[model samples]
Target: MNQAGMISTSVSTTTMISGSHLFNISGHSITKELPAGKCIMSSPFVVGGYQWAIMYYPNGLNSYDQPGIAFTLELQSEGSGVEARLEFCLVDSHGRPSDIHKASSFCEFGYVSCNRGFSGFITHEELEESWYLRNDSFVVKCTVGILDSSVVEASGCGTPGNANDTHQAEHLPPSDLHEQLRKLLESGEGADVEFNVDGQIFSAHRCILAARSPVFHAQFFGPIGEKNFHNIEVEDMEAVVFKVLLQYLYTDVLPDLNEFGSIQIKETSASAIMAQHLLAAADRYSIERLKMICEEKLLGTISIDTVATTLALAEQHGCGRLNEACIEFLSRGGNLKEVMDTDGFGHLMLSCPSMFNLILANINDPNVLRDLVIRFSKTSIKS
Candidate 1:
């Protein structure tokens, strides 16, 4: 109804819906045990007809430069696009939002950019002293507002008004293939092969092992494949190590170091001992991913008592980065003298005599060189 004697129609107006979710994270100290980039996801919540979740990283996102914890908003449902306003705030002891540590942002959630987060939402030091943290537990409130809008048009004449089209996207759950495989491994269902390791028997499927390891494939299915496929005896690898290797082959997860103990052959952390043996077993089986995991574990647990032996293991296994890192750590002030006095150092000397040259090349301190020469000469004379 207008001055032009024609009717104009408006299709729709903008709408917004908002909701909040609170995450209760207990055992905060235990959560910190997880490595950087590892995260705990909150349960999914629905707001404005879409599902969303929160991702909390106790040790930040990047493996290096972890200044604080990280928090991210994740869109769990697939959709065309969503415009959202997100706010994350810690709940204080009295159940109110903490004023000092609040973060807010307006972001678009789509297939291409489905995740938005803060790297350092709050520093570790600040959080430790803040009242928001209590009893090794904390709560975070996440608020989300979903915005939807349709084109508003001023149309003249009898031209039909255009309507916005919306499609229903299917909701897909996260994959649990690894979990199913782990169940298969645990249940020993349909297992066609058996392995005897150090008097302990393990049952597994030949196809799965063949699929996971090239060595197993050649041993089980190749032209020179084993004539008796039902029973295979593995040598040199411990039963526990073989058990962990099979778990990784099926589940692709690292072993829990707490479940294992030190090898007792040296004065080193339990994790370092387990990782050392796993590294050797990984090399023998040609599992590159497991090898890399063992390497990272060893690198993180390096100490004066373990570095020399670790360096020798790295050299024998051709872990170049680990080899260089060990050399670099040993070259630092006073580390050489301390490491040389340990039993691991004697083993390192005997196993890798040429590594002395590598260590000397990295050392620039004259006093360190003199002490190293004296130590080496004495060890040599003693041997």
Candidate 2:
């Protein structure tokens, strides 16, 4: 906040020009003093589809009466014949551009021509008094116009004399199917099946499950269909996980992580455990979409303790996306040493020794890859 009781900024953001590019030169001060003919130029910055630079004279022109430095926002692109409209100004410490000193001029030049902004930008005495110069520097803002209203792209696929500017309707949320199934699942009016997982029974509609999952369809009504089975015994997953899986089958949306009583979700315990089991169940049920969805959820909540285990699951289930994410996260190299101490990491090494090769292969950058190997070696000795 400034002395005024309102919002504020250090350099005023460009807003006046529309359809034009603006470039700002911050810390625009030259350390070395220059002679009468010398000038310091800023590095080239892109604006309005062209390269640009700001040239500033440190000392005033003694031959002329101008006291401070003169600034020029010029085209830096070589071998380009262009006549560009330029607007330049000095911005105050409080981010207010000086409208009084701002200049608008046309620069016509190529690689050889003298293409720059208007002259006599500001005086030294004026700069010291004005709030524009703060911390021995100021901001020079420039806007270069690119096009007029007529430069739009040509459209119409041979339907002559008709503009045919019809736009497709915006995508609506996937609410209809999700809501209908959720309602059906909750009401249990058409529910025809019950799943008993870990001694907990979850009632679901056989038709709905079959429509959503091919495995369910096969199990309930396939070539060797066990159509008469009312309650099916589900294996290898906790009741809560099975319940959540049923919810996903009913609705396309994943429930909030917070809904599952997740405390410290980033660690190896319950948070990703749900997702891990969901991935396994999705794979078993041949629900490719659900498998990918679970893989993504597991990736987001991964921590040092869970990364190795997640990677192992990713490999086992042929989840290429999650597998890549795990390697990339571990390749940061700083966290590898700590991750190594976890029992999951031990299990990963024993079960899938090739994951180390995968991690090493993904670390293309020499610096981070080196750090990762060094950390792994050190951690291995300690472990």
TM-score of each: 0.56, 0.49
TM-score: which candidate is best? 1
- Residues 1-383, model 1: lDDT tens digits: 34443335556677879999999999988898888889999999999988888999988886884568899998888776689899998986557775447789988888632788778898765665455668888999999998988886654334223322211112346689999999999999999899998888899999999888898889888999898865589998778888888999999987696587734454547778888888999899899999998998887787898898899999999997688667756866678889987888887887888899978876767888898888878777778
Q: Score each candidate by Cα lDDT.
A: 0.81, 0.66
RMSD of each candidate relative to the true structure:
17.2, 17.8
Worst 10 residues of 2 by lDDT: 7-16
lDDT of 2: 0.66
What would you estimate as the lDDT of candidate 1? 0.81
- Model 1 TM: 0.56
